[model samples]
Target: MLLLATGDVIAYSYAPGRPGFLSGAELLRALPPGAPGAPGTPGAIAVDVVAEDVMAEPSWDMSPSTMLELARRARSAILERGFDGVVITHGTDTLEETAYLVDLLAGRAAERGAIVLTGAVRSLDEPSSDGPRNLASSVVAAADGALRGAGAVVCVNDEVHAARWVAKVDATSVAAFSSAPFPVLGRVTGGRFERLSAPPPRPPVFAGDPASDVALIKTYPGIDPVLLTAVVDAGAQGVVLEGTGVGNVPVELFTTIAELTEWGIPVVVASRCRTSAAPLDEMRHGAGLATRVGAIGARGLAPSKARCALMVALGTGGIDAVRDWFRKL
Candidate 1:
């Protein structure tokens, strides 16, 4: 098994007298060499570590280009080295989105090995730092045979969550990541993974590079239509709307959505609420207008995931393809 260190795995001294992250070299040196067996103990199999920077620093400074580069490198290493699994150490801030992107790109490769993402809410210098344990649990989950074909998953705080559904809901707690409206795939307790659900399979969505020109418009009370128009005028190829309950946009924005659809721009509607799926049925006036405007419903996807999927879909094909992809989701 291979453990890929992409910034967050290591602690860095960002400033004087403050908590810090582990450096890649430092983190590698801290781990015991062996296969990850159970959560608390190291396995008997061989484990290797590699360091690469997926971001400039451990903060929320990630770019789409950086994520693509990291994913490409990880994929190459996994395929070329015949590693049984790859455990990625990432920062918690944008881990969910980056993991989803990897899942979209590497889901089919899961048949050969697992791709598990893990990180700490607290830096290594903190008194109650969770990095080492999270790292161990991630390795255990990655090395387990049960994870084969599970696609990309986030293993944090001893819990394994599918990348598509997991969100960072808290900023301080060690147990910050959660999967709602979906049960976790499994948990890593006592140094071993006990499966609760099978890992999901997601095929690659785009053959070429991602367009990366999509925009997310979150609707609030009395938001100006010009904001939506400005996005289009600024060359956004697709848009994801984080609407009110059940995917409802302000009634006034329906015509704007219709215009965008008519102008060949794809629009996806996702709800701000986290619990339920987005139903586009005409049960509400706003949703009814959305249905009429031909905006795609995000189904069970969160806003960020919907944006990523839209970006991939739009870059690969166009409006029709994005609609089909959302329909299936």
Candidate 2:
């Protein structure tokens, strides 16, 4: 209650057709003249948390324009009003990324009050919408301290997920995000919090420059080394091969990647499908052994999140640190 909420409007094509528009100004203006429900709702105080438009602007970190203002207000609101928590409205395009970023940036204040991230599918103009519900639940979750630990959370379409694992997998479904490699921490059913699992200790996050030159290579039929070689020539600091099942790539492309590794660039081996990773157990020859030489394994991480981890690793001290960070995450 009396929670601080942050909102952003996406300015890019987040999915197939329509762009991910945060529409913060519109939502702020439509905030029910006050928090949802009757006046003086007991045990809950609600406040809209508005932040700047975080224009991801593509291949870069997107942050709301009102981010700093929101942060200042959040710290002030919590310390001054003795409120329960904070809720954020972010674009699904980079919502998870931003959520985890804020979680780390906010430090241990993460444990002090709930900081939940929520987003919408249709524009606010649509009917039978989920925006209001999602926003309300975030406040509810925060007020209930469902966001008290495990870093910032992305609460949407009745599902509560960790920011680190939440991604806009589906472009249009209300249930756009899925918490892969993790379980749903809770859900909103019948207007109340239904926690199925408590979050584990949040994984370590070493944020690298979002602009870092990193590319993920997904092996496919007729795969050619020319494309991968192009990425390496483009000055990619790292390469993530989204190889075939069990981390096998075109035998031809594998050699190219290996050659890139030999050139001192870090080549990370990951899988393109499912929760599988490069066959660390099969590091006997070919790509398997190439992984043995210097390739880092993304270990069950989705390609997007793996890319994030790799960027962070590249920004860190060195290769060993990067390897340890990946293993830990």
Candidate 3:
């Protein structure tokens, strides 16, 4: 297994009043032999570590281009090293989105080597630091043979979550990650890993640049049409609208969508609600408006995921292909 560090594994210094960033090498050097085997297994599992200081910055200001590059790197390293799996240590902020992006970008080859995204809610300097244990659990999950096709998983606080379903629900708690409506893949118990089920097949990789232009606009009460117009004017290739219940927006927004589609800019409708989305059937009123205008429905994807998918779709295919892709999704 290969362990990659993005420096968030231990960003803060352990001692109070001392101001300095902890290096990835420092974190790795401090880890103990915490890797545990499956229950009744004889030997300790071994993990290969990447060189330190790979990621220049520990912050989460990673752009779409950088994220896509990292995902490609992970896939290449896994294949070249013939590693069973890979673990990435990232910052909690925006971790879920990064994980989901990787899940979509890492195609068939990556399915053979599962990718596990992990991070800590607290800095390593905190007295209640959970970084080491969480990192260990992530390694265990990545190394599990049964999770070969699980796409990308976020393993933290001992629970294993599918990258698509997992969200960072809390800003401060150690148990910040959760998968709702959809259950977790499994959890680590008594120093052993467990698998509930394999994740769905990895999404097809986009045959385009990772930094494809896409914009996300959240529909709010009294949202201005000019804002939507600005997206088109700004030359965004596609737009993701975070609509209200059942992925509906105001009537004017639907007209804007029609205009946008006419301009060859695809608009994907996604619900602002976190848990679920209603069907965008022709029978529904607000949803039907989108259908009348050829706007694609985001199905159950969150706005962020919708934005990511639209970026890929816009880069690789035309509006029809994008609509069909979302329809299948």
Name the top TM-score candidate: 3
What lDDT score goes with residue 316 in model 1?
Answer: 64
The estimated TM-scores of all candidates read 0.88, 0.73, 0.90
Name model 1 segments beyond 4 Å from true: 13-21, 32-46, 55-59, 201-205, 275-288
lDDT by residue for model 3 (150-231), tens: 8888999999999888888898889998888788898887666898866654675566665457899988888888888897
Backbone clashes in candidate 3 total 0
- In candidate 2, position 253 carries an lDDT of 64
The whole-model C-alpha lDDT of candidate 1 against the native structure comes to: 0.74
lDDT of 2 by residue, 1-329 (tens): 34333343312224457545544444444544445332334443544343334332331345333343444455444556665566667667777665655554444456678777787775555665677777766766766755676567889988888766666788778888997767998987755677887775565654443334678877688987888789878887778877755566666665776676677667777676665433454543444544655667776666666665676567665666666766666
- Clash count for each candidate, listed in order shown: 12, 20, 0
Better of 2 and 3 by TM-score: 3
- On TM-score, the stronger of 1 and 2 is 1
